[model samples]
Target chain A: MASTHLKRTSLYDVHRAAGARMVEFGGWEMPVQYAGIVEEHHAVRTAAGLFDVSHMGEVEVFGPGALESVQRLITNDAARLIPGQGLYSPVCLPSGGIIDDLTVFRLTGDRFLFVVNASRTERDFQWIAEHTRAATARDRSADLALLALQGPKAQSILERLTRADLTRLASFHFTDGLEVAGLRCLVARTGYTGEDGFEIACAWDAAPALWSALVEAGRPHGLAPAGLGARDTLRLEAGYMLYGNDIDETATPLEAPLGWTVKFDKVAFIGREALLAQKARGVARKLVGFEMQGRAVPRHGYALQAEGRRIGQVTSGTFGPWIRKSIGMGYVERAYAPPGTPLQVEIRGRLEDARVVKLPFYRRS
Target chain B: MYPKDLRYSSEHEWARAEGGRVRVGITRFAADRLTDVVFVELPAVGAKVTYMQPFGVVESVKAVSDLYSPVSGTVVEVNAALADTPEVVNSDPYGKGWMIVVQPDDLRELEQLMPVEKYLGLIGEPAT
Candidate 1:
């Protein structure tokens, strides 16, 4: 085999033994799919799928002003969340542009864990540490491993192996020290997939054991080892925003169609004033969902047009499994933002027919 | 792995003569690596395709790849089943996962492609 520069996951050898086609994703050599992308995608959609998402960054943000400091860093109201409750937030720059979108779980009064995207993990931690240098938030990036158990049947499969009372654990809430096949771990009711799932954060050493156990426990339930391929498709179908692709440093919370995460009620934060100003003036380009008229799927950076002139660009596009059609989201003029508005996506420099539709092309039944 | 009856290309596509036209699909090794066959862009009937050039696209969940034609010809048929059932490629890649059919411009060009043993050799598999 040719020498590849991509770093391997903890489960790299396991994936290699499974004949997985590994690809460089966010600097980690992750299995793009174990069996095939569509099968693994449908596995999670219909049955259960396990993913080794150890590349995601998990940092500890605990101090006397942990809630207050976390609240200041993110666009969302993390101070309002109860202990064990998880809330999605976008960490922003001074200009109200996003650094990364993450989920913060208030593990305790003084301790919280912030789960961030894999690609922006290092820079995000650096930015957070630099902001909170005096505040005492510890950046514990090296000590954690993330595992996602997703699909329709994920809960039942997990319930069998872990003693964690998953039924009472509502979406976005979690408890630490749950025993998974005899290993203590922090399991969160948060996932990138729109389907009901859990993101288990475990000790680095316990990853392989817990992974093996989860796979064994999930076997009877039709759970398969899924890769990055299924993960992106599932998230895209759910209308979830990816940090670098969908929104980034040049994209603000207000312009990215994620205004709900920002709370102006708080006195001040990094991007509060900028978000507030945008709120009052109204955003020019809005993130909206649309369906392409043809089979050609629109990809990231593809231009969005109205009538004939280019207006914006597609941030993400795919053949949504649940919807069984080409659906996408893009930043377009607010004039073309409302559902049912006609638009076009310029794919490969040729205009293809499209229509602005409501967000969320798929909702679990 | 490429079967003895099939002709293979360096691009990982396989073509087999079916009813006087060539039936084509990606190899099992290609499908195994690409992992989920989520969506496939099938070529239109009557469209001309050339050797070593792309005729369509195949997308997994995370990446999109081009589908190449090993033989030059006009497309006579395409697998419409993949329009709504792309996973069939993963499940039955050598059988029902066939992508398109084309009447070869040169029948001798089929021999110019990799033979079954050579195809297996190219993919690093033991020839049957």
Candidate 2:
């Protein structure tokens, strides 16, 4: 896509000044790398890394029926979440096909926030608006900028700038009205990368100052300003799924390795019935992780073969720098989903040996 | 900037002809654009390579691009070091990053390749 018309985040100047390589990502001109992908990836794995995730969209649902509306719209049981808690879930079509995978944060008993993918912001907003009964949904994307401080030292780096007791904040929980770098922001103890981190959402105009402060505070901790490239590799290593690359509108939670996110026991959700039926009959296809047995790097759209026949296609693949090996995820027939099953990835017209491993090729200790 | 002594291919490869044997590697331009070469798959040492044909593959963190042979030849020697240190292709594209040494099928094909000035123009890089 032409980057000329792409939107720039509030930290555009900062990224440019740092010599970040900018690319068109989901309608936004975002940094894909700063120093380099591998360097930034290692930094996050070993120390800390800061990221501008302002491209992500946030929609706030407010009213007496907010909880009910969220429960009906998302596959996860939002009602189970008390105030200050968040949960990852897939918003699905009536057919059980995934509309978007998102995180829902319960700010209060009658207020909630849905953090949706940047590419699906408009669609998600429209879908939620249409499905909302008495609740009101407002798109807060443009007004807010999100930053992720991730890695082993993320807590230490953030704690230096904030008075909030980050040690008490558990995973998947958020605190609002927190003063980060002297700027009021919502701090969520969550991240796409498997590392311990906090995602801070602050006013758009205040993002530059907040980012500068975090970078300054994190310097002693070996923090680097990472970009989308490292973000992809880090999340993949952590076994987190990318919405467009891993799961899309055509796949359902059951088949996309996200069955855990589908709360079948919930009262009723958009795709609950279809998912329940699929559970009863068993899903025909399943997403599985695999590792290349050879040096060849598996890539997205590469054909997955078994017994000399094309059985599936790689949904997402990359050389896991942290793992020091090539790993990927793909959907194949249920019978071939077993770990250790022999497979081959057709890369550049050559079939390279691989085997089905387990999901989450890498996990934090 | 590209080395003036090397001949350039439109596909961003460079060749240093020494008699009938030519050393080949991707240019500095290609390396910068690729930004951190993570993996490289080279043709077998004895394999036949055709001009402008894909003889190998190079992968960066975000992309996989084919490495086109700058000249048809027999791959007499491959840079085995790249298997463990692919970033050399980025760090020293014209030196330690040399991918393969080839015995060209025809010396006349060298005349068809572009000189440093023309190659720089093709990529819109100011000639140094």
Candidate 3:
């Protein structure tokens, strides 16, 4: 409740002037909503939504041994990434517990940019620096600001502002030195909303200008400025995991539905052995998606039960606006993780029936 | 504005006496607090409700809150239009957003509720 000492993003003033309801998130004062969560949610789904994601931490790792160091630190195969490509992977503790999930952008042969969660920024930087032998890691979080233009109409809106051939940018690909609104930016055809969008990374001081430009240009396209509330719903509907919520230190990547990112065939990485052992022995619990059968909305920390006994707890839940149902994700007993498995969630001390379903409650056509 | 003719509860519900029955709905203050009501779940008609007990739930995009009954009674009617349009609670809290019509067990219990002035004072709103 005491957020006086919380840090402010570069777009804090802009958010406040727009009448956003601010909340302290991960030690930063960020807007939770500007209009309303449901309204903004539909905006991103039908048209476009602009998001100020400057709070996400950025780390620059550059040296002759950058590739080797990064490959050793991450579970995924960083060697497969060429310049202008980005890879999403989870950084794991040696015991295979997830430290943090991050996106690695290959800038050059010896330079990589890591976009990490704001809450785990310090820890991620420390862990990466301590593990690497020769790669120099610089925390560039304060130097850069990130904006996500997401939705089905995002490309069309963005194409009007930037001269860069956005049509050529594929998913998980980024191009630097793109002139957007006459300002230098690194535009990536990536987003967490499960839509065709772009995330623009630019200088911290230039954030307000870039945000205003996008807002103005995006107005004719039905673009609304969204906040953290809509972001959570959008990502949850997309079946994307949120750090400190869906996956944390207490849960391993294999248990949290991220085993696909853990490449065992790649060179030795931290937690590779433990992950391999877990894979061989099989996991005791697995994360699965579920939809409520009744009107009850599931929430984090809600108990999951089977028959009359508790199985696990819900890690994340929301009234998915697009799906028009209460959807949630939790690590239930592996036996109950199969699609169509019936489960019960204890909401407000009452058991509500729910069914485990395949992930991505909302899939874009 | 708090309606002068309606009795208010500290829990932010308003009740209006209609002969032997009472009309119940959330107050404007409550509706504003629960912005963008996306869903409402009300007790079925003919169901009994107890005073200060949760009889339904109102869900916004970000949160879910229980709706407490202001008086012990039997639900005679529920707003069916809310099933498809819950935002009515925000737009018209006292009119179309009325949650239920209840036949109070005792009409005298309505006198125990606060008047508009007292209820407004409790919520730090000046009495009009």
Candidate 4:
């Protein structure tokens, strides 16, 4: 029995009307697909795709210490984020284990917003609130709805609906009060698919209107209303880690190969000491991207074997629709983390051949 | 859509009898649930399979599922074409998407499977 109450987005009715296949994901009854997974995945890559990311959580931080609190809470250098800019970071426990991977937007010099994972909303908010002394943290997950319009045609499609000069909105920059489809929304030129796109954040109840407008305006551009299924594959192809899947409480950012997110120079943050120690001693095991040598689909929890021994386990694996290869990511002994290292993933009792490759399996051309 | 001439298993496999050999594949309902099937692993020809047992694997980008056998038999043929172009399973699940042909050990085994009407009922589809 599902004990936890499942949440639904404001676009729930619209998704149902569109004949989306619904599935329970991280305590939310969300649409996993609309047209089809591969179809929607292709649409996002080739043209454009709209996504309902309403289930993702948002934590608002305000007050004089907002910048200080955010800097201390995350592994990345949030102080480097100028107003109207956002940066991805990992919220880590004091033990250096990842609490969540979130994006912090600097709305003002003293105001910040942390966009967190749906499942980690409560944990991240509590962690952030407890650690901050002067800044106030409020969970705004219920107040906001996020939509991501991604792909090559994303800018052109969104341009038709809004008068704003999106071309001037550089990547990782956001305008909090941009009017889109006659509604004031926060539009960010950031995306998870490694493509040029915009993440539109609007009031919770206005998502349906925004969604319908985007769908209508994007009709000529071949925009598909994609769902979680396509979202997963897109992120995977881009080598973006899914919190619970690729990184978790037991894995540190260094082990996750997310050392770039850890800024050791910034006035001592959580997990800074432990990460420094890990760096000095060298990470015992490291995450690496891999491609299957055969057709066997390596999946989560599958073992990574090398030299007749189990080296580590697969964290995430899938047949990437865009890349058209069986690609995956997993932690392996530091020795086997190098690109081109031979490896094997035990799938369904058989040791299938695999080899470590680069992090991203696909890059937008 | 479930065809009337075929028999179906509760696991969503369809078996169409061609004399003693039954052509087997997943139903449209199953294919829809497993959207964008990218890879299919079928049993080799002459491999033995049991009734209601897993005979192969069908993997989509999101998940992997087993293909259940509808009757005890030996694999006579496999849709090797699926290895290169598995999306056909989503487009033509009943025709070019056929997974295997099995020579049943017992001809009467077909009767144990559900009729199209019963299968539609099993999947909560309105039986016409």
- The DockQ figures for the candidates are 0.45, 0.69, 0.53, 0.85
After superposition, candidate 3 runs with Cα above 4 Å error: B1-5, B44-51, B105-128
Tell me the deviation in Å of residue A52 in model 4: 0.6
Each prediction's RMSD over C-alphas, in Å, is: 2.7, 1.5, 2.2, 1.1
Candidate 4 iRMSD in angstroms: 0.9
Clashing pairs in 1: A36-B35, A36-B36, A37-B35, A37-B36, A38-B36
TM-score of each: 0.91, 0.97, 0.94, 0.98
Ranking by lDDT: 4, 2, 3, 1
lDDT of 3 by residue, A1-365 (tens): 56778989889999999989888899899999898888899999999999999999999889989999999889999999999999999999989999999999999999999999999999999998987788899999999999999998899888888887888899999998899999999999888998889999999999999999999989999999999999999999999999998999878999988988999999899999898999999999999999999656788889999978999999999888888888899999988899999999998778999999998888899
Off by over 4 Å in 1: A1-5, B17-25, B38-48, B73-105
User: How would you encode candidate 3's per-residue C-alpha lDDT over B60-127 as one tens digit per residue?
Assistant: 76788889888998999999999877889988999999999999998888898999999999999987
> TM-score per model for chain B alone?
0.94, 0.97, 0.97, 0.98
- lDDT for each residue of candidate 1 in A234-312, tens digit (9 for 90 to 100): 8988889988889999999888878888888974788998888888999898999998776667889888999779889
Kindly report, for each predicted structure in the order presented, the TM-score of its chain A compared with the true chain A. 0.96, 0.99, 0.99, 0.99
Model 4 lDDT per residue over B30-128, tens place: 998888898899999999999999999999998899999999989999999999989899999999999999999997998999999999998899988
lDDT of 1 by residue, B1-128 (tens): 45778988888899898767898999998887665567788779999999889898897655578999989999988999998788888778889899999998986778878887887888788867
Q: What are the per-residue Cα lDDT tens digits for candidate 4 across A260-334?
A: 999999978999888899899999999999999877788998999999999999989889988899999999999
Over A5-65, each residue of candidate 2 has an lDDT whose tens digit, in order, gives 8999999999999999899989999999998898999999999999999999999999979
For model 2, report the TM-score of its A chain. 0.99
